[model samples]
Target: MKKPFNSKLFFFILATLFGVILSLPTFLQTQGPKIILGLDLQGGLNLLLGVKSEEAIKVRYATLASALNHYSIEEQILLDKLVVGEDNLSFELLDSNEKSKIDKYLSQQEGLEIVEKDLQYTLALSANEKINLENFAIEQAIGNIRNRLDQFGLSEPSVIKQGSDTILVQLPGIKTQEEEQRALDLISKGGHLQMMAVDEARNARVATMSEREAQSYGDVILPFINNPQQTILLKAIPILDGSMLTDARAAYDNNGQPIINFTLNSQGGKIFADFSGKNVGNRMAVVLDGKVYSAPVIRERIGGGSGQISGGFSVSEASDIAIALRSGALPAPIFLLEKRSVGPSLGADSIRASLIALISGAVLVILFMVFYYGIAGVIANLAMVVNILLVVAVMALFGATLTLPGMAGIILTVGMAVDANVIINERIREGFRAGENFIKSMENGYMNASRAIFDSNLTSLIAAVLLYVFGTGAIKGFAITMSIGIIASVITAIVGTHGIFRFLQNSIMKSGNYALWFGYKQQVYKRKL
Candidate 1:
């Protein structure tokens, strides 16, 4: 003697209504969390980039050389020979007294193999260390590229490792050439900011000095960013690098030109203060990737960990640089192995095809359920619709991307959504033939069908989880949609349908018509002598 619609049904209806509300913004293209179309579903740039991981080893070697050179100058240790080899650097100590200092420096280093014959020492990376560095370079490149894309305000850009030495990048909504070029530059920007002293004693003769002569004097000739024809000679060793940068932003200067303002971490702040305090009246060149942006004379101590780079950049260029700096430098340079731009028209065609397939599949499933199960089939169809809505609503709530493969997953789920109800309906039909009451029949039906539904959905969920964990790009998208769809189907087809049947149970029992309610004829008993 319960109400026609019980509290269970009320809660079920509320959940469906909540799903509808959550999905509305996405379907209507309004604000709030919405599903993003993937590269195949929307026009975008697809790139296969090869990371030059080998260059990482060279960079490490060069870094060691720089550190050694800087230490020699700081400690005033004379050296007879200082040469950077292809795999290592070799230097001979001219003063025997400095051997202890050099040995201590070598001890503090992390990964290096050193050989000494009298005063000359050779240093190189161990085989395992080199291999590890190369592998780390690839991972670091992927992380940096993803971080840059995320900060560039691009929507759901895909950056994944394709293989041991390559990356696959999918940037959605990059239609124009300008956008593509900007994205390319942003991803490739090394962001190797260095602050080097402008070798004041020899800078005056930079125009006439040869490259070899500058190297002999521990200086490097770098071109100016604004005018590449002009060059400045800076000390080879950098006083500071971008490794310490905590944040960077594009801002306008007093002259209305765009500039990059940056902040540094605690260690960098202390170094900046000490250097500026001591180097007053000396120029310090702001170098980035072998190009000097500015060389301003340090007039007084600069503190607070803040600095600016002024290079006459446009707003867009400045913004890109700022984003790159904030995202950190790539461990190695990446070259484009392949580039493909997906056209919007192609995406339109794909979307149309996918929609046609999904709708067609769902319609056929809905019709089959209605035809076979009759009134009970109608309830199952209702559950299928609610299941689909919940899947979409949850994906939109999470801002997940929708790809073509993902659409295919939803289509597959549509056909599978009513499976639980199919089992339950058959069980109840069997009960009706065995002379069971309407309420007891449904209760037995659900109880018997529960295990099958649980086992099937549980196995499917496990597969989806594995697919998500090990699969890449499109496979991951497919896995996500299928996972969501399966969970929603369990809720709608199993739990929701049971509640709905309970809500309609009293009417069916009072009507005493199993044929209309369950699409089956009831057996009539005749008295016999």
Candidate 2:
């Protein structure tokens, strides 16, 4: 007689225990499994952003112009007619014979193509360099948005590159309109911060003169946030920008007003310390997104790479500023191509409908199985229950998101799980009709049916893998649940049901009663030789 406690039974019991333990956290509402619901299931914000690649190119050119301006002054190179155009930089050489000298200087600069025409040189980014810059901008934008979202406390956000110059952002579980707006504003804001010395003389002149007149004097006018009528003219050169910031946090000032305190990196610290030490008592404009937040005069040489931006801001505003500052600036501005908000009520309806469909399908499958195979059917039903449990447990264990399609996959699995049992039962019935003993017929049923079951399930598993690799969000969810279900079905339908049959045969069922339990009649067949 076969032992009641065989290796297959032992494995089935061990797997069931492990799966139950893994699934316990989900049932008990504890902090074990970190499974997150998808955006469709939880209701959240979805934003599609288009990166302004052209603007990125322009910004790169402007930065290069700044570098050239600095080099010209430091190296005593007379670069005349320096024009920072929209798409390229153009400059005239001081001497036509000095073309070789300028070429040597420019050869050291990377990502640039220099062209000479009639003693005038134009510099633009190479084609490959432009593509690389655009790609980098998109990548950096994703990273910046992710950092901001992390600080904003939204969990399990999906921020990925959708296309060449577009990004897809999904913030799960955000239901409120205020929250939606806040998240959108937080992400869309460019957050370009710069510290430039306030040009008081130019400011006074700009008040009396035209806007173009101030530009002629190498000044840029930015309006104050608190008082838009009041504007400050800042030097064209900035002392430091947000890229130098290492950390930022929200804090309360002496008067209990919210403020953002920031720390700069080592290089920024040295530059800021030097600039502040030499320009004590001079006002410096704190500009963010082209708007002046504050203009404070330096009281002393501010060292330690630390400073504060204090304005009449609310606590939430201060927090937003801190998050933006800490996350650094986006490489270029983003345009909101599409915006969508999913309400919790809609998600709730989806969940209810999905649950109904799943339960209805499972119940129907269970009833059909019980009606067709009788005692064997009951055993299959038990295995099906275990199969579902193992599927959920695996999903929870892997922290995979559950979606509406995933529910459909589970429903489909119920039918597939029963199919394996049906194959085995039919094979066993065939063996019985051929006048085989109960033990020999049952063993033959499992062994003969195993090949077909393995082949079918193996093909399904391969399809699931391919779907997961190439499919999008919801499709990937379906593939994941389907893969887990297929694996669980194989274990339950074969090992789980076979172990139960072994136990029944070894411990409960008598050899003579096998035909009655198996729901088949033993028939002697004559073979013609």
**lDDT for every model?**
0.87, 0.82
- Models 1 onward score TM values of 0.94, 0.84
What RMSD, rounded to one decimal, does every model reach? 2.8, 4.2
lDDT of 2: 0.82
User: Model 1 misses residue 270 by how many Å?
Assistant: 2.1
lDDT (10s digit) by residue, model 1, range 1-529: 5566777677779769978988888889888778899999888999999989988897777677766766776688997657666688788998899999999999898889999889989999999989999999999998999999998889999999886789999999998999999999999888888788899998889999999998887678999998998999987767778888999999999999999999999977877887899899999988877789999999999999989999989999999999989988787888999999999898899999998998898889878887777788889989998988888899998889999999999998897789889999999887877778777788899999989999999999999999999999999999999999999988888789889989888777777766666653444412111
Write the residue-wise lDDT of candidate 2 on 219-276 in tens digits: 6678898889888788765677777889989999999999889989997787689778
> Model 2, poorest ten-residue lDDT window?
520-529
TM-score of 2: 0.84
Off by over 4 Å in 2: 21-35, 65-83, 90-105, 115-122, 160-166, 427-448, 508-512, 515-529
